[model samples]
Target: MTMTSAMPDGRAERASTKSFYLIAWRWHFYAGLYVAPFLLVLALTGLMMLWTSVLSGRDGEKYYTVTPAQTQVAVSAQADAALAAIPNGKVVQYIAPRTEEGAAIFRVNNGDASSMVAVDPYNGTVLGSWDRRNGLYDLANKIHGTLMIGDLGDRLIEVAAGFGIVLIVTGLYLWWPREGKGFGSVLVPQFAARGRQLWKSLHVTVGFYISLILMIFLVSGLSWAGIWGDKFTQAWSTFPAAKWDNVPLSDATHASMNHGGVKEVPWTLEQTSMPMSGSDAGKMGIAEGQPVNLDGIVAFARSIGFNNRFQLGFPADDSGVWTLSRDTMSNDSANPLSDRTVHIDQYTGKVLADVGFSDYGVPGKAMAVGIAFHEGDMGVWNIVLVTVFCLSIIFMSVSGMVMWWKRRPAGASRLMAPAVPGDMKLWKTGAIIMLAVSLLFPLTGAVLLTVIALDYLIVRRVKPLKRALS
Candidate 1:
């Protein structure tokens, strides 16, 4: 039960331990002070993101075909019913419908152009037109996203994420044991061990193992809120322009395409080919503005190879075109248009741009794959990886906060580590390690350093705190 000194030279050990804390604890104190609020917000928001995902989970609505009355009613008729349901002055942003099921959704402007409402296509029933931010779930989302304070909240989150990355990295460095120790000691918690070392062991050992996953979450999340993420997304998405074979659209159907803006026609009909964005004629030429036979168009798509297709995203502008992207579920590719995209004319129904998975560019393919990885779309195998990453984020958020909280002092704490007698080598050594570890968390260190510089002028040089910590 007696402690034995392993150090052969006591003096040497004493020397190393002496100023350790003065350097370390002080560093830990200020770093935490600077970014605690930010860290806290990130944790809170992250927790919400986690819990909310489950609450919001719903199977994509299962579709059932309406009776003959419903099927006989065209989109135009449903559009009329919806018109009467909505308060006048509002405009439709988009009308989405399933021909087979006869269910339609109109994303509408709720008088005020800035906000929108979701309307039922079947009966023109108004689900609700509410501000997304003001709703309970949305409020949580905004708070999690921007802290509800707007730009300041956004910047704080970014800064916090930046610091979080730093914390994970430095926590790893601080966690490194002095060489010779092997896996079991490092990995398994020594339950009987008391104080800081026990907790640090739990935090670092577990935290480091999960860091890569945490980093992915952090980076992916940042993409949702920043320009860098958009750039990353764009870089990864397929820009079909370059790889596509650009043919002239001169002979392409001179039929009125969309409501107003021009759109490219699907280049090829078969599974092997994709529509290339053609020349100015294909881009601009369109003659008749006659209303195309809606039923015929639908039948044509079915005949060409787009069976069991997901909802089509009809293009809006001149550069826009109708595309039939497939549903990932059911592995349905029977329709030639089934596993791919078919961009056709609005009036003549001529193919403008037809692209399938085969022609997707590297970036496009990478994006598809990366997103699948990010979202756990691959398989049960990938779900394991995705689950690990999500759980890691939950842990990192928790541990980082706990470490910060555990280190903080009892009251209206200042941004400085409390000092103990440097004369005791053990205390000094512990303090220094704390300081170094805290410092390693770049944000904490920077904040502490700034506080140290300021503390001299205020607490010591100016007045009050001299009585407190001293």
Candidate 2:
């Protein structure tokens, strides 16, 4: 009697395991079907940007390489040269070169148009100029960030990223070893397997190997998404204006400087208010009787330890403060630890507010580090690792599609998604988990709800549609 009861119990356990596996597989299918295309695009564009950055440096850096000289030209003279190069334009910002042998870059604005002029710091000669944000790297950045369709594209990518998290979670569950499967099968691919089994093994092995890094990519990428990143996460993680020592705030935030799909400031300070310049309420900075001009600001920046590769933003208006910013996100510095931003009073030349990585809150700090990793700015090893990771993603995406195609029956009209199980008592738990994900990522949640509604109200009742979609 005991042996007979044991046999029934074992059978019941196997059935339950099979039921849950089927459910997990269905969710994995749903996520992969939606996320694969976006993953491909992201991987390709990311590779393009990374290789370009590593191979050629920033867009116009090649033309700006110069020989180091004993005596450097004045900052004002460099600005004059930049403006002279781009006739009838106002110098909006000055970028100190990464090395003594590199030329200073001046961002000159002519009405609606803007350009970057590379001027030699040694003799203040105009080396070359190019339209700002017109490089291939910048174009690839727009496509990667927002698909180049603006706000709508941003929202869609956010949804895809949300689903990407779902894909990773479900993929892990599906890959988890069952009762008879050994640990070796989980980690290493079984080349001995043939047909669909071989493809499945490759897909599972690669997916499992890259799961953690892929999740990091998704979360960091989502931090820049419009709804989840801008509206929610960024709003919460923004550096506090209260830390600015009661300085008068401007209507514009630090994000205003981030135009044309480029990040010019640190992520932690992007949403924080910019300090106004007119107020005389700050520490002594540029010294008395020294005019707060480009030359004075440059010297002050140097005095404050802002040496190579820092940006000096000109005052936008009478109330605008001169901004000194350096961060890995903007490729200003190689070290993420040294990320800093300082606002100086345009009239008084006093340092109004200064923020660094240490000043950021917990979330702000995490994002700062994460952004550096995401952009491959840490070092040469970082670039190599990220490149390999990107290639892995592309491989996983293609392999997943091939696996699905191989599994589907020939001439099948339906999508052939994993079959829904009968007597599935665990569905309610799955629903709750999905609901939580929906709450966390509202855009993805909306898409899930819409699909459920369509499936229940339309697809389930219509016979032809049911066959086509199931």
lDDT of each: 0.46, 0.87
Query: What residue runs in model 1 are displaced by over 4 Å at the alpha carbon?
Result: 1-40, 46-84, 87-104, 110-137, 194-198, 230-470
Q: Write the per-residue lDDT of candidate 2 for residues 234-342, one digit (tens) a residue.
A: 9988998998999999889999988878887888788999999887798889889999999999999999899888998999999998999989888777688899999
Model 2: how far is 10 from its true place, Å?
1.9
- For each predicted model, how many residue pairs clash, with residues at least 3 apart or on different chains? 27, 0
Scored by lDDT, the top model is 2
Q: Write one digit per residue (lDDT tens) for candidate 1, span 152-195.
A: 77656665655555555545545555446766665676677666
Residue pairs with colliding backbones in model 2 are: none
Residue 238 lDDT, candidate 1, scale 0-100: 28
Model 1 residue 224 distance off true place after TM-score fit, in angstroms: 3.1
